[model samples]
Target chain A: MWYIAAMALSIGFGLSLAALAGAFGQSRAVSSALEGMARQPEAAGQIQTAMIIGLAFIESLVIYVLVIAFLLNGKIPAVDTIAAVMEKAH
Target chain B: MSLELPGWLAVAEEVFIGYFGPSYHESEAVFHAALVIPLLLLFVFLSTRRLEKIPTGLQNFAELLVELLSKFCTSLIGPHGLAFLPLIGALFLYIFTMNMFGLIPGFKSPTSNVNVTCSLALVTFVATHYYGFRYQGMGYLKHFAGEPLWLAPLMFPIHIVGELARPLSLTLRLYGNIMGEDTAIAVFIGMGIGAGYLPFQFPMMALAVFTSFVQAMIFALLSSIYISGATTVHEHHAAHGEEHGHGAHGAAQAPAHA
Candidate 1:
């Protein structure tokens, strides 16, 4: 039971942190890009394209955490396995 | 309470297994990868036959997609980017198709499998280097060397690691997105059965399709950006000439327009 809880917590905390960082990074990137475009409307096309690519790179870092979680997720104790262990304990 | 389930739901688990190997992981993603080819062939044949001066059917749709894809590539990579239309277009269409396929009740997206995504990423990796070497010849290796000569040792490994991370990032991005979408949809449907209530599927499927497009666009766009980076010198020179022309026009028009 302790093992399962730890596993769940790590995955939850891991992704939450990742998403937090990613969201902040993306908003900053877009905000900066918007500021640039607002100052130079002629450069809006270039800024928009660069913004999309920058946002993807930022998002991918978060996805990397999810990938690690996915690999670890398989190792989590299944409910059936835990139930069987409880029955054996009783 | 017993409920009726769609016949297709029953067959959803079935997929044609690939004969390529022992079917490592015994997963059917391999078969789906193989299946994309014949599907494309059939689609192309059906859509392109009997071209008319004015297309009225699938041909029109096909032409429109081609135009849109080429325009997208040109915008990102510039004029010379048209030369990369075939590679960019195929990657976009294939990734998009594989992604959307998962939304079908009985179909699985091959991209949900890491192996399939790795193969896709490998192509991008190889192309990035191949064009880099082709464009810059021996100078391509210079990119690996850090800006200052003394930093070569530190920068070389860093560059190599960063380069290697590109494919891993591409693979993980698509695989995780599609796999997560597939899992969410499956789990929701399974819940409907378990809770004895109709699954709240409409929103899930809609989100799946939407994310599928987003993922595909990201993959294709990144691939083009990598290719453009690989051939930077050529594009840089070309853009220089175009910029001069544009500058002259802007100067000439600023007074008249303003």
Candidate 2:
């Protein structure tokens, strides 16, 4: 029971933390890229490409966490199953 | 939360099972991917049937796509990058089509499946190293060895890990994003069914279109970057600092931006 609860909690907390960090990172990257484009509109294309690449790289990290959450989610048994196992153990 | 949209291919599978027994099972993703390939080939065949100096209709669309991809390849990978247009352009079209396929009723996005994305990433991984060796020969291994000769032992392992991580990251990134998007759309669709058949997922479908394009573009862009990084010689790497700078910036900016 405790194990299942912990696993569920970790998945939630892990995803939320990753989302928070990813959002911050993406915002910073877009802001800087926008500023650069504003300074040199002619170079906006180059800056935009760089920005998207940077965003993808950052986004991949969050995706890594999501994958881990998925793996952990799979490991979790149903609450009813756990309760039944506990009853049997008793 | 485990609700999933039923794909048309599932019905086909059922018919096959009824006719051929249980031995004829096939995944919907595989069916969708197979369906997409022939459709893509048919499009290419139709578009190229009659080449015209003054393009129109399908020919114009095909030419525009090729031209945009050509420019993107050249801009990112220099003149030599044109050699990779076939691979990059094919990836963009295939991935974009697969991503958007989920928006159609009774169809699923093949890209939402990790196995499909993993295979695509493997192609990029193999192509990257193949071009690396083709361009640099045995000297390509020197890249794993850092600037200081003493650092070779440490740097070699780090480089190997980084190289391996590239495909893994690519696989997970594409798989997770598409899977999440599809699942969201499915959940919304489920809600719509409960709400007297309101199209609750219409807005999500619009967002999916944007994300599908972005994801496809990113996949193509990163594959080109990886290939270019592997193929360019050290001399060109230093000389074209501005062009190479994007690769370095992409790596360095990750943590700082985060």
lDDT of 2 by residue, B1-258 (tens): 233687776666676766644533347787787889999999999999999999999999999999999988887776687899999999999999999999999888999888999999999999999998999898788777755558889978888888898888889889888888888898898899999999999999999999999999989988988887787666654445433222354343322221
Each candidate's interface RMSD (Å, one decimal) is 11.4, 6.2
DockQ of 2: 0.45
Best by lDDT: 2
State TM-scores per candidate: 0.82, 0.88
Q: For residues B118-204, what per-residue lDDT tens digits would candidate 1 score against the true structure? A: 999999999989988997898777667744658889978877887898899899999888887787787788887788878677689
Chain B TM-score for each model? 0.80, 0.89
Give each prediction's DockQ, rounded to 2 decimals.
Answer: 0.39, 0.45
Name model 2 segments beyond 4 Å from true.
A75-90, B1-3, B20-26, B236-258
* Fnat of candidate 2: 0.55
